[model samples]
Each structure stands twice: as C-alpha cells, then as structure tokens.
Target chain A: MSHVGYGCLMAVDREHVLRSAAALLTRRATATMDEVAKAAGISRATLHRQFAGRDALVRALEELGIQECEAALGAARLDDGTAREAVRRLVGEFESAAGLLGFLYTENQLFEGEEQNAGWSRIDARIAALFRRGQESGEFRIDLTPAWLTEALYGLFASGAWAVSEGRVAAKDFQYMIVELLLGGALRREES
Target chain B: MSHVGYGCLMAVDREHVLRSAAALLTRRATATMDEVAKAAGISRATLHRQFAGRDALVRALEELGIQECEAALGAARLDDGTAREAVRRLVGEFESAAGLLGFLYTENQLFEGEEQNAGWSRIDARIAALFRRGQESGEFRIDLTPAWLTEALYGLFASGAWAVSEGRVAAKDFQYMIVELLLGGALRREES
Candidate 1:
C-alpha cells in the first residue's frame, strides 16, 4: 500500500480504539487506563504511547466526538429539508453518539464556570442555527428559543438512550420517542 | 406536644435526613458515608443507623423516589384535567424533584435484569391512561403511544432540570421551555 493509504488506515485504527475506550469509560467513568486499554484491544504500552495519560485520551475522544457530530450534521443535510425533518434525521444521527454525549453532559457540570471546549460551542452554534432557520422559514414554532430547544434535544436524547438501556423503554423506539415528543408535542391534536 | 407527636416528628426528621443524603449522593455518587452524613447535618452514627451502608442508602433512596413519584401523580390530579394540562402539572411537580429523578434516571441502568420498583409502573400507568383518555376525547394525536409520551416527558424533565442547573438555560423558563417543546413543538404555529 502507498504511504498515504497506510497512514489513513492507521488513523482509522486509532479512532476505532479511541471510540471503544470512550464507550467503555462513558459507562464506567472511573475506569482505569489499563481497563480502557484492554477494552480497546491495545497493550498498555501502546495505549500510553497513543495517549500520554487519561486526560489526553479524553481530549482526543472529545475531538473525535466533535468530528462525528460535524459529520452527522453534514449527513443530515439540514439545509435541504424542512427543519422538522432535519431534526428527525439529526436525532437519528445522534442516536449512535448518545453515550459520549451523556459523558460530556455530566462532565461539563462537574466544572461549572470553566470554559467549555470550543468544539462543543461550535457544534452547538451549528445546531442552533438549524433551528433558527426553521423558525425563520415558518417550519417550527416560535415560542421556544433555538438555544433552549437545542439543550432540550440533547437532554431528551440522553434520557431516552439511558431509559432504553435500562429496559424502561424499548430500544427500537428510541428514534420514534425522541422525534415524536420533540415535533408533535405530547398532547393529542384536535382532528379536523 | 404529646409523645405520639414527638414520635411523628422523629420519623419526619429521619425521612428528611435520608432525602438530603440522596440528593447529595445523586450529584456525587462516590461520596463517602461521612460526606453524606455531613451533607444531611447528622452524625455519622445517625446516618449509619438509618442506612447500614452505601447500598442500603441507595435502596432507601430508590424507595423514596418511588414514593415521591406516586405523590406527584396524586398531586397532579391526572384524572381531573385534560391530558395536556395534566402533563403540564406533572412536569411542574417533577421539576422540584429533578435531582433525585436525574439520579434514579442513571441508577436504574445498573440493575439490568432486576425488577424495578413497582411505583414506577404505577406512575407510568396513570400517565399513560391520561394520554389514552385524551386520545379518546379527541384532544391528543393518535400516532404516538402513551408509553412513549410518558418516557419522553421523563427525558425532557431531566434535560430541562440539568440545563437550568448548569446555567445553560434560565430557571424562570423551565416550565415554559418544557411545556412549549413538549406540547407546541419547535415548529412555528400558523397564528404566530
């Protein structure tokens, strides 16, 4: 294989390891570096070489999350569809990343008043802008602000994911639960 | 007061102590027993006397959560009002117990196959019945199930509470944010 192709393959492998570690750590936030390494199928030495320590590894995971989110936004094609449809596609995209989002959601709370990672804010802005565009185009309701809607979406997604994991709700219903609640409101609409 | 009154007061105090500890531990799950005692302003001995250990404490909290949820269901008067109004009241009651709810929201995941406390099922039944009532009355849309709506409400409440706590969203807007998003949705209304 060409050098560039080999490098790309290596980067993909690294990301796979990092994401596995992230999934494990998210469920068990206090997991040791050794356990994370084991979960990723990498030796301790290699894990240390890849990430200097736990904090460095988490930072890398955060970057990975940001990249995935950007990719989801692109894939959802927010610009092409109605805001409501866009949100549905976005929620579906976000379903896979729910665990990481849950971790970051709590982690941000631990250090109140500290600056949030800039990547998160950037992603938030992009999501918020989508909602704003929907409102402007008369596709969404005007009562709630784009900011609160964005936060609510994040919270509901985390809650729905956790609920499904706990068997309190069905796993297959995650997308339907979030989208229906967000778009249709829980109240029964009057039939014409 | 009479001896019986004094006994009643002591029982109330015990309940208070347990709740304060649960609130503290919900935010800091790994906090030591001493920390929990200090948080409740009770002696370590008293705390231990009430709850034999961390496991005991969590179990008590789980029971307390179940009871509180039942109380909320009663207080919300789910049968008397329209499902929309009932949900609004339900969300209002839940807002006050947001911390405990958030804690249970995560804790329930740990007991994978164990039977959940029966109180949750009862509460779910009440909420779901209200939604069904609304549907029959031509007040709610038929597409979404009452079960999903119930779960969605729980998710949105947790998310809204966390957002308010982190200062990402305002406390004053809690009710408005949740109700609007859950009821009216993000789509702009025709009249708006």
Candidate 2:
C-alpha cells in the first residue's frame, strides 16, 4: 500500500510538470529548456531529469496531447447519440487541447522521417471510426472517405487554431465553427 | 526594338528559373540554394544574382505563388458565374499551384514577425468577395463568415496538398475533395 501511494505521487508530480511545460511551449514553440524550467518554477536540473532536451520535451507534449485526446474521447461518449450530436460533443470536449494539439500538428520536424507515435494512430482510428459510424448510419455522405475526413479534421483543427491565434477567429466559437463546417459545410440547406 | 526583345527574354528566363525553383522547393522545402541552382540547371552565380540567399529565394517563391494565384483567380473568373460554380472553377484552377502554395502556407519562418505580402490581401479580398456574393444570393449559409470561409479555403488547400503528398488522397480527387467538402460538407443532402 505504501509503495502504491508513492507511485501515485510520482505520477501526479510528473503530470503537473508536463502540464506546465505544455502551457509554456504552446505560447512559444521556440522557448528553451531553461525557460521551461523557469516557467514551471523548478530547477533546470529537475527539468533535465524529466525531459533531457527540446526533442524529448516535444515528445512529452505529444504524449500529453494524446492522453488528453483519449480523455476527451472517453468523456465525449461518442457512441451515445446521433453521430452528428456525437461529433458536436467530441469537438466540444476536444476544444481545450486545441492549442497543444495545434503545436504538435505543425511541429513537422518531430514527425518527419520518423514513424509517428502510435498514440496518434489510435486517436485517428477512433475519430475515423466515428465518421464511419455516421456513414454507416446514413447520416454522413458516403462519397468522402473516412480517412480523408479524419485527415481533414486535423487540418481544420490546425486551421482553427491558426485563426484563433491570429485573433481572426473567436476562441469561444472554435467548437461551433469546426463542427458546423466539418459536418454541415458552408452550403445553405433548403428546408422543406 | 532590341531593348524590348532583351527585356522579354530576361522576363521569360527569370520566370522559368522561378518555376523550376518552386517545383524543387515544393518537393523539398528544406532544399538548399545550391541544390535549387543545380536543379534549375543554372549556375550558383546566376542563382545568387537572381536571389541573394535562401531568404531572397523564398521571397521570390512567395512572389511566384502570389503571381500564380492571381493567374488562377483570373482563369477562375470569380465574377462571371454563380458563386457555387465560381468556387468550383476557382478550386479547379487553383489545383495546379497547390503544391507550391502549400509550401508557402506552411513555411512559418518566412512569414513570422514579418508583415505579410500585400498580394495576399488582394487575393483574400477577392476570394472573400466571392463568398460574400454566395451569402448575399442565399446560396451559402450565413452563420459562417466569409472571412472564415476564406481562411478555411487556405486550410483545405494545405490539407489537400498534404493528403495528396502522403498518397492517402489521390491526385485526381484533389479538386473534388476540397471543393465538395468546402461547399457541400459531409452531410447527406436530402433530395426534396
């Protein structure tokens, strides 16, 4: 029991450190390790012990993004309602991580010439599965493939993040805009 | 006159060199200036004369992208047809430069902390104007702003380029996927 408690404490500390690191990196992608340590109110030595370098920190950020995405998916209950509603729920839940994910999405150097972390594949699969479910249920059009839709989701996520960062898109509307555009598109649906 | 003939020759050569540079850089954004000169079959001196360094080369590429976008916009005839049809034509014409445009879109270093090229404003206003036309004609839903639509177009262009590069999305489907997704969305339209 004592060992389990100790393990829990370490995990909690590690998560706190990662969260602080992510917050700093999201604001300034080029921030150095020393700055990260400063922002987290920890010693540079401790930061080094946790993440040895910039690349390692980015990898940790990528891991954090994946964990949060999984958590959001779990909370979204994407299987509970109409696929459209489920998408709305997913987008709503996913909005909090938009900044972090946007950073990871555009940080191409970390991904180039390397096989992406398997966590992303799992996340993509889940999202694509949701799109497939919509298609199977006749809610989504069948012409666009699930893979394409999944890719488009990431693209929109990055674009929406870009818009918000540029002060062009309001943060509160990120979820509404992304979900509406992805699901309903820009055309006026003629009501009967 | 001989002067006019010489100027014309210089213009053609410069455009040719820029086109080759664009093709190479689109394939490899990290390609060096020496490699660009080599690929363009021009001497380093000539390449340097034309572009003093990578920054200048990139600026030239940006100019090329702007010029091509203008040409595509001209060919698209954004003013002549129904907004929907106009968007389709615009996307079709824009497809040829997707690779080069995608390069410029993601090259954040070239644009960060710098005032964006004025050419983009002209291009964006034109595209946004097209969307506004759609909204006024009741051809598009109004909840989504024309600015957002224009921003989304750039996002989709980058995404479509990315998909085609990864072989996940076929080249033939590039225009179809982008146009259909941007206009019609993913929902199955109810044929009333």
Candidate 3:
C-alpha cells in the first residue's frame, strides 16, 4: 500500500509538469526549459531534479503524449457508436493534446534516423482501425484507404495546431475546422 | 544576344541541378552532398563550383521551389473557370513539384528565426484568394475560412507526399487522394 501510494503521488506531479511543458512548446517550439518550469508553477531546481534539459523534457513529453492518446482512445469508446460519431468524439477528446501532438510532428526530425517511440505505432494502429471500421460500415468512401485517412488526420492536427498558434484560425474552431474538413471537406454540400 | 544566350544556358543547368537535388532529397532527406552530385549527374568539383555545401545547396533549392511554385500558379490559371476546376488544375500542375515542396516543408526548421522567403507569402496569398473566390461564389463552405483551407491544402500535400514516399499509399494515387479528400471528403455523397 505504501509503495502504490508513493507511485501515484509521483505520477501526479510528473503528469502536471508534462502537461505544462507541452502547452508552452506547442505554441513556441523554441521555448527554454526554464520557461517550461515556470509554466508548470515549479522552481527551476525542482524541475531539474526530474529532467536534465529540453531534450529530456521532450522525451518525457513523448511518453505523456502517448499516454494521453491512449486515454483519449479509451474515453472515446471508438467501437460503441457510429464510426463517424466516434471520430468526432476522438477529435474532441484530443483537443487538449493537439498542441503536444503538433509539436511532436514538427520535431519528428529528431527521431529521423533513430527508431521512434513504439507508442506512436500503437496509437496509429488504433486510429487506423477506426477508419477501417468506418469503411466497412459504408459510412465512408472506399477510394481513400484507411491508411491515407489516418495519415491525413495527423497532418490536419498539425495544421490545425499551427493555424491556431499563428492566430490565423480561432482556437475555439480547431475541432470543428479539422472534423469538418476531414469528414466533409471544403466543398459545400447540398441538403440531401 | 551573346549575353542573353550565356544567361539562359546557366539558368538551364541551374534548374536541372535543383530538380535533381529536390528529387533525391525528397525521398532521402539525409542523402549526402556527394550523392546529390551523382543524382544530378555532375562531378563533385562541378557541384561545389555551383554551391559550396549542403547549406548552399538547400538555399539554391529554396529559390528553385519558389520559382516552381510561381510557375505552377501561373499555369494553374486560378481565375479561368469554376473555382473547383481551377483548384483541380492547380493541384495537377503542382504534381511534378510536390516532392520538392515536401522536402522544403520538412526542412523548414532550417529557416526558423530567419525571415522566410517572401515568395511563400506570395504563394500563400494567391492560394488563399482562390478559396476566398470559391466561398464568395457559394462553391465552398463559409464556416471553413479561406486561410484554414489554404493551410489544409498544404497539410494534405505534405501528407500525400509522405504517404507516397513511404509506400503506405501508391504514388499514382497521390493527386487523386488529396484532391478528392480536399474537395469531397470521406463521406459518400448521393449523386445529384
């Protein structure tokens, strides 16, 4: 009981730090570790006690991103409702983490040659499965493969994040813009 | 006439080298300068005479990317027909240069903190205008802003290019996938 209690306490602090860092870096990818520590509402000495530098912080953020994605997937209940609805829910749940995901997408060059974290593959597989379900259900078009749709989701998330950060698009509209563009496209649809 | 001929000849060689470098780097971002020289079918000495190193090579490529984008825009004739047809034509015209655009998009970190080339602003504004044209004509959804659509086009292009490069999606399907998803989306529409 004592060990479990200690582990839970540590995780809460670590999670808070990761969330704070992600929110800052999502908008400003070049922010310093000191800024991250400040954003997390902790002293620099306390922050350094956990992570060494920006690189270490980013590595931790990657793990946090993966965990958050998994949590979103679980919370969305992807298989319970219609795939389209499922997709909408997933995007909404991801709204909080989109910034982190965007930062990771742009900074992927860091993992260019090195083997990327395996967690991404896991998250991708789950999302791909949802798209596949949509195709099987006849709710989606077949010409665009599930794989392509999955990749496009990542691209849109990055674009949406950047657009919001640049103030070109309202942050409030991020989920709507991406969901509408991904599921319905730019063309105005006639009432059926 | 002699001076014009000399300039034209130099321009042709320069264009050829940029295309070759863009093509090679698009597939393999980490390819060596020596490899780029071989891909361009030029000697290392000759390549160095033109550009000293990879940094100079990328700078030259930036100019080539801008020139190619401007050329595509001109050839696309964005105002010629229905905005939809114009967009389709613009994308098709950009096909040959997508690889170069993709390469530059990923390597954009190299330009961070520096003023980006003005040509990008020029290109972005033109593309945004096309979306604005479409919206004004009721051809597109007004909720999705012109700026967001333009950014989405760029995101789709990068996604399509990456999908093609990775063999996750077929190369031939690149343009169709991006255009269809951008224009019609993943929903199956009832034919009017």
Candidate 4:
C-alpha cells in the first residue's frame, strides 16, 4: 500500500481505539486510565500518544457522537422520504450508538455549566429543523414544537438504552419500542 | 379539634416535612443531613427522630414517590379520558414530583441487583396497566408495549426537569413538551 493509504488506515485505527475506550469508560465511569487503555487493546504509551489523558479522550468521544449523529442524518435520507420514515430511520441508526448516547446524556446532566461542544447544537438544530419541516408540510400535528420533539427523542433514546441494559426490556425490541412510542403514541388508533 | 384529628394533622405535617427535604436533596445529592433538616424547618433532633439517618430519609422519600404516583394515577382519570388526555394528566402530575423521580431514576440505574424496591414495581404495574387499558379501549396505538411506554415517560420527565433547570427549556412548557413528543413524535403526521 502507498504511504498515504497506510497513514489513512492508521488514523482510522486510532479513531476506532478511541471510540472503544470512550464507550467503556462511559459505561464504567470509575474505570482507571490503564483499564481504558487495555480495553482499547492498545498500550498505555500508544493511548497517550493518541489522546494525552482522560479529558482529551472524552472530548474526542463527544466529537465522535456528533459525527455519528450527522452521519445518521445523512444515511436516514431525511429529504427523500416522508418525515415519519425519516424519523424511523434516524431512531434505527441511533440504536447502534445508544450506549454512547446514554453516557453523554448523563454526563451532560452532571456537567451543565461546561460549554457543550458546538457539534451537538448543530445537530440539534438539524433534527429540530426536520420536525419543523414536517409540521410545515402538514405531515405532523401542530400542537407540539419541533424543539420539544427533539428533546423528547433524546430522552426516550437514553431511557430505552438504560432499560435494555438493566434487562427490563429485550434488546431486540429497542427500536420498535422507541419508534412506536414516539410516533403513534401509546393510544390505540381508531379504525376509519 | 379532637385528639384523633390533631394526631392526623400532625402526621400529615411530618410527611410534608420529609417530602420537602427529599425534594431539596434530590436536586442537590450532596446536601448534608443538617441542611436537609433545615430545609424541612425542623430541628436536627426532630429530624433524626423522624428518620434514623440518611438511609432512612431516602427510604421515606421512595415511599413518598410511590404514594404520589398512586395519587397521580387516581387523579389522572385514566379510565374516563382519551389516552392523550390521560397521558397529559399523568405527565403533568409526574412533573410536580419530577426531582425525586429523577433521583430515583439515576439511583435505579446504578443498582444492578435484583432487589428492586417493591413499591416501584407496584407503581410500574399500575402505570403499565393504564397503557394497556388505553390500547384495549382503542385510545392508543398498539405497537409500543406498555412497559416501554412507562419507561419512556420516566425518562422524559427526568430530561424535561433537567432541561428546565438548565434553562434549555422553559419551565412553563414542561408538560406540553413531554406530552407532545411522547404522543405525536418528532415527525409530522400525515393528514388523513
């Protein structure tokens, strides 16, 4: 392989290691730095070279979350399908990253004063915009604001992930649970 | 008032004091026992007499949450109203005790053991039954399980409370936000 191709592969490998460590530490908040490094399957020196310390590692995780959200939005084909389909796609993609999202949700609650990494705001705006578009297009009900819908989606995502982790709900049912509750609600629809 | 009436009043007052303390401490988890006593407006001795220690205080708080949830279930009039109205009432009442609920929600997450407080299970069953009733009566959609709907309600309450506290969302809109998102979802609904 060319030197440039090898370097690209190396960067991708580093990103994977960082994401694995972040997911582990998020679940096990008390995990020592050494534990995190070992969990990533990289030596302490190599981990340090990739991320100077725990703080740096967390920040990278935050970035990864933002990036994944953006990627999900793209893959969801928000523009091509009905808003309902788009939301289902978004929720489905989000399930893959639910653990990390749950970690970040709790972390944000604990550390409210810190400036949120800007990427979340951008993503929030994008998601909220989708809801607004649905409303404008008469695809959604008028009573709820887009802003609230976005926040509620986040809440349900976090809740579903935690419930699955605690074994209160089955893992396979996560996507179905969130999508149905969010869209059609708990009420039984009347037959026309 | 008669002796029995006086005793009943005193019992009510004592319960109120304990609940107030719980609400305060839930928001600030690290509050001292003295601070809790002061918030309750009772002397440290009286507070200790009512509850043996922090553990006792927490247990009482949990009991209070269970009772309040039962009361809300009764007041929500789940049997009479449309599922949407029932949910709105449920979320509204749940919002009042949201701080304590949030504390318990996070606490339950840390507790990996099988021994959940029985009161929680009772409350969960009652709420889940309400959802099932909605489904049976044709007031709610059937795809989402009653269990996940109940869990999502808890999660949204916590998130809404936190968001309001942090000024991300206005306090006035808490009920509106939770109900709207839980029912209508983030997508625009199609006009029939």
Candidate 5:
C-alpha cells in the first residue's frame, strides 16, 4: 500500500480504538486499561503504544467528544434561519455522540477540585450561544437563561442516553423525544 | 428527659448522619464510611452501629431518598389540581432532596447488574402517572411518553443540582430553572 494509504488506515484504526473504548467505558466506568484493550480487540501493547495510559486514553476520549460536539454544532448551523430549527438540527446531529457524552458527563463529576478539560467550556459557550440567539430572536423564553438552558440540554442528553440504554425508550425515538420536549416542553399549547 | 425523648434524639442523630453521608457522597462518591461519620460529627463506631456497612449505609440513603420523594409527591397534592400546578409544587418540594437524589443517581449507575433498589421504580411510576395525567388533561403534549418525561425529570433535577453546586446557576433559581424549562421549554409563546 502507498504511504498515504497506510496513514489513512492508521487513522481509521485509531478512531476505532477510541470508539470502542468509549462504548466499553460508557457501560463500565471502572474498566481497566487491559480490559479496554481487550474490548477494543487490540493487544495491551498496542493499546499502550496508542495511548500511553488510562489517563491518556481518557484525555483522548475527551478530545474526541469535543470534536464531535464541535462538528455537530457546525453541521447544525447554529447561525441558520430560525433558532428553533437550528436547535432541532443540533439535537439530531448530537444524537450520535450521546453515549460518549454520557460517559464524560459522569466522569466530569470526579473533577471536583481539579481543573476540568478546557474543551468543555468551549462546547458550553457554543451551546449557550445557540440558546442566547433564540432568546434574542424572541424564539425562546427569557425567564430561562441561556446558561440554565444549556445545562438542561446536557442533562437531558445524558438522561436520554441512559433511558435508551435501559430499554425504557426506543433508540429510534431518542432525538424526537428530546427535541420535542426540549423545544415544545411537556405542556400542551392553548390557543390565544 | 423521658425515654421516648431520648429515642427521638437518637432518631434525629441517625437522620443527620444519613443526610451528611448523602451530602458528602454527592460531592465525593468515594467518601469512606469513616469520613461520612466524621462529616456527621459522630464516631465511626456509632456510625457502624447505625449502619452495618457501606452497603447498609447506601441502602439507608436510598430509603431516605425514596421517603423524601414520596413526601414531596404527597405534599404536592398531585391529584388535587391541574397537572401543571402539581408539577410546579412537586419540583418545589423535590428541590430539597436534590443532593440526595444526585448522590443516588450516580450510585445507581454502579449497580450494573445488581437488583436496583425497588424504591426507585415506585417513584418512577408515581412521577410517570403525573405526566400521564397532564396528557389526559390536555395540559401536556401527548407526543412525549410518560416514561421519557419521568426520566427527563430525573435528568433535569440532577443537572440543576450540579449547576447549583458549581455556582453555574444561582441556588435560589433551582426550582424556577427546572420548572420553567421542563414545563415551558426554551421557546417563547407566540400568542398565548
């Protein structure tokens, strides 16, 4: 194979390992590095070479999650026509990252006094900006601040992920369930 | 003091220990039983006498969480009025248990294959019923399932609790933040 093709293959392999680690860790937060490699179908030596250790692997996962969120935000086009439609698109785009996001959400609770991944703040600001746009456009209620709405979005994503995992809700319904309730709420609209 | 008064004092002490454990564990899930006792300002021996072991202590915490949830549901008078009003009251009442709820929320994830504390399913049913009532009353949208709404409530509560703890959102806004978002969504009403 050509050098460029081999490099592409390596990138694909790295992505596979990261995704496998994310899936396994999401199911069992305390899984060891050896177990992570086993789950990823790679040798422990290769796993170590790929990721120096558990901390490095976790950091890589964090990076991957951030990239996914950034990509999803970009694809959703938060600056598009209507903030509501933009949010719908965002949730739809974000659906794929829910499992990885859930793992990171729980992992973050352990960072009490420690410095958190800076990537999180960037993602938060982006999401919050979407809510702010909605508020500015009079598309969203001002009573709920952008910050709180952003936090709520994270919470609901984690919740929806868990619910889907436990068979409490269908996988197919995940995006619709979150988007409708989030954008429309549980309340039925009455005619003015 | 009378023997009954002395017993009452012991009960209060036990309750205090449980609450302290919940608070500490919410902040640090790995807190030791000894640390829990210290946080409660009691001896480890006394803590052991009250709760046999970590499992026993966690079980006691689960019971406390359940009782608080049931109490909140009762105090909210869920069946007496409009589902919207009932949910507001329920969120108001449940606000106090957010710390314990948050701790249990994380703790349960570790249960993996273990039998979940039955108390949780009972609470789930009760909360789901409230959502069902809302839908039946035309006060809530029918698109979202009662089960998903129930799960969303859990997510929002945990999110609000964390946001409050981190000072991301004001402590006083916890109820409003959850209630307004859960009921009204981020979108502003166009006419009504």
Candidate 6:
C-alpha cells in the first residue's frame, strides 16, 4: 500500500481501538489492557504500541471523550434558537457519546490532585455558558446556578446511559428522558 | 460488664466501623480492608471479626444504606402531602446517606449478573412508587416513567454527593440542589 494510504488506515485503526476501549471500560472499569485489545480485535502488542500503558490508554480515552463531546457541542449548535431548544439539540447530539462520557465521568474520580486534561475545563465552560445564557435569558430558573446545572447534566447523561444499558429505559428514549427532565423536570406544567 | 452490655458495645463498634468504611470507600472504592479498619481506628482483626471479608463488609454497607433509605422514605410521609413536598422531605432525609449510596452505586456495577441484594429492589420499588404516585395525582409529567425518574434521582444524588465532596457545590446546599433540580428542573416555572 502507498504510504498515505497506510497512514489513513492507521488513523482508522486508532479510532476503532479507542471506541472499543470506551465500550469495554464503560461496562467494566477494571478491564485489563489485554481485555481492551481483545475487545478491539487487535493484538496486545499493537495496543501497547498505540498506548504505552494503562495511563496512556486512559489518556487517549479522555482525549477521545473530549473530542466527541466537543463535536457534539458543535453539532448541537448551542447558539441556535431558544436556550431550551439548544439544550434539547445538545442532548440529542450527545447521545452517541453517552457511554464514553459515563466511563470518563467515573474514571475522573481517580484523578485525585493530578491535573485534569484541559479539554474538560473547555467543555465544562462551554456547557456552563449555555446554562448561563439560559439563566440570563430568563429561560432557566436563577435559583439553580449554572455550575450546578452543568454538573446535573453530566449526572443525567451518565444515568441515562446506565439506564439504557440495564434495559430500565429504552435507548431510543435516552434524549427525551434527559432533556425533558433536565429542562422541564418531573413536575407537570400548568400550561401543559 | 454484663453480657448484654458487652453485646451493645460491640454493636456500637460495628456501626462505627461501617460508617468509617463507608466514608473511606466513598472517597476510594479500591481502599483495602486494612485501610478501612485504620480509618475506623480499629485493628484488622476486629474489622474481620465484624465483617468476614470485603464482600461481607460491602453487604453490611448495602444493608445500612437500604435501612437508611427506608427510614427516609417512611419519614417523608409519601402518603401525607403533595408529591413535591414529599420529594423535598425525602431529599432532606436522604442527605446523610448520599456518600454511602454513591459508594454502593459504583460498587453495584461489579455485581454483573450476580444476584443484587434483594433490599435494593424493595428500595427501588418504594422510590419508583413515589413517582408513580405523583403521576397518578397529576403532580408529575407523564412523559417520564417512574423507573427513569427513580434512576435519575439516584444519579442526581450521587452527582450532588460528588459535587459536594469536590467543593463544586456548597455542602449545605446538597439537599436543595437535588430537590429543586429533580422536582422543579432548570426552567423558570410560571408560578414561581
């Protein structure tokens, strides 16, 4: 194969490995590197060559999660229409990354005092800014701060992912469950 | 000391050990039993005498969590007031167990196919029933199911616990953050 073709193939291989690792880790946080490579249908040697060790693999996963979240945020068009509509769109766009996000959400607990990847702060700021926009526009309640709302969004997304995994909630309904509950809540609206 | 007095003292020691273990494990799920004993200011021998092993200790924590939840539910007086009021009361009462609940929430992921403690089912049903009661009373939206609502509540509780631990949200506002977000959501209510 041509050098350029080989390079493109390697990029695709890396993407595939990262996704497989996300899926495996999402279900079982304790999965070994061999387990991760096996899930990716690749050799452990190839996996190690790609990621030097568990820390490297995890860092790669964090990078992938951040990229996917950023991509989702971009696709959601957070600046479009009303803040509620933007939130709905964001939840819908983020559905595909729910598993990876859930994995990262729990893995983050292990960071302790270690420096977090800067990508997360960027994503958090963007999301919190969206919440702040809603609050400023009088679309969202002011009593609940944007920071809390952002954190709650993360919690709901992880919960929705787990619910879908356990078959307690339908995968098709993931976006509706999160968006409706986050924006509208469990209370019945007087207008509705 | 009399036999009864000795038994009572042993019971108190066991409770202390369990709470210490819960607090330590809440922060570090991978903490060793020796570490747990150390946190409780007891010897490993005494810890083992109380709890046969890690599984036994975890099972004890689960029981404690379940009992606390049940107590909270009973105190919330689900049948005596408006659904929103009941929810607020429940959140207030459950705050103390948030850390232990969070610990158990992550720990349960390891049970994969192993029978979950039956106590959880009872707790789940009771909580879900609260949502169902709200729905039947026309207090909650019909779009979200009780099961999803229950899962979301659990998610938010864990999220609130973590946020409080990380100092992202004030420790004092834990109940308010969860109660308001879960029942009322982020949107500004027409009446409020």
Per-residue CA lDDT of candidate 2, range B1-192, in tens?
457455544532788889899887776777778888898888889889878888888888899899999999999999987899999999999998988887887675235577999998999999999999999999999999888888888888877887898788999999999888899888899963
Clashes of 2: 0
- Model 1 segments beyond 4 Å from truth? A1-12, A25-35, A43-49, A52-54, A111-114, A166-173, A190-192, B1-12, B43-45
Chain A TM-score from candidate 6:
0.94
Itemize residue pairs with steric clashes in candidate 5: none
* Model 2: per-residue Cα lDDT over A1-192, one tens digit each: 467455544532677778888777666667778888888888888888878777888888898899999999999998989999999999899888987886787675335578889998899899999999999999999999988888888788877877888888898889989988998888899853
Q: Model 1, B1-192: lDDT tens per residue?
A: 467555544543778787788778656655788988898888889888778887888888888888888888889888876777887897787777777877777666566458877877887898889888888887787777777777777777777777776677899888888877877777654442
In candidate 5, what are the lDDT values of residues A1-192, reduced to their tens digit?
Answer: 467555544533899999999999987788888899999898899999888899889989999999999999999999998999999999999999998898898788886788998989999999999999998888888989899989999999999998999899999999999998888888888753
lDDT of 3 by residue, B55-158 (tens): 89998888898898999999999999989898998888888888788778767644556877888899999999999999999999898888999988888887
| Predicted structure with the largest lDDT when compared to the true one | 6
DockQ of every predicted complex: 0.44, 0.52, 0.49, 0.41, 0.71, 0.79
Where does the lowest 10-residue lDDT sum fall in candidate 2 chain B? B3-12
Assess candidate 1 and give its lDDT.
0.78
Among all windows of 10 consecutive residues in model 3 chain B, the one with the lowest summed lDDT is B3-12
Per-residue lDDT over A104-172 for candidate 1, one digit per residue giving the tens place of the 0 to 100 score: 676555545567789888888989999899888887877788888888888887777666765667878
> lDDT tens string, model 5, B46-153?
888888899999999999999999999889999978999999999999999998897788778777899897888999999999999999988898989999999999
Q: Kindly report which residue pairs in candidate 4 clash with one another.
A: A139-B188, A139-B189, A140-B188, A140-B189, A187-B139, A187-B140, A187-B141, A188-B139, A188-B140, A188-B141
For model 5, the stretches where C-alpha displacement exceeds 4 angstroms are: A1-12, B1-12
Please state what fraction of the native interface contacts candidate 2 reproduces: 0.63
Better of 3 and 6 by DockQ: 6
User: Over the stretch A107-145, how does candidate 3's per-residue lDDT look in tens digits?
Assistant: 664456688899989999999999999999998999998
Output the number of the TM-score-best candidate.
Answer: 6
lDDT against the true structure, each candidate: 0.78, 0.85, 0.85, 0.78, 0.89, 0.90
On the 0 to 100 scale, the lDDT of residue A37 in model 6 is 92
How do all the candidates rank in terms of lDDT, highest first?
6, 5, 3, 2, 1, 4
Clashing residue pairs in candidate 6 are none
Worst 10 residues of 1 chain A by lDDT: A4-13
Which of the two candidates, 2 or 4, achieves a greater DockQ against the reference? 2
lDDT of 6 at A45: 91
TM-score of 5: 0.92
The CA lDDT at A131 in model 3 is: 90
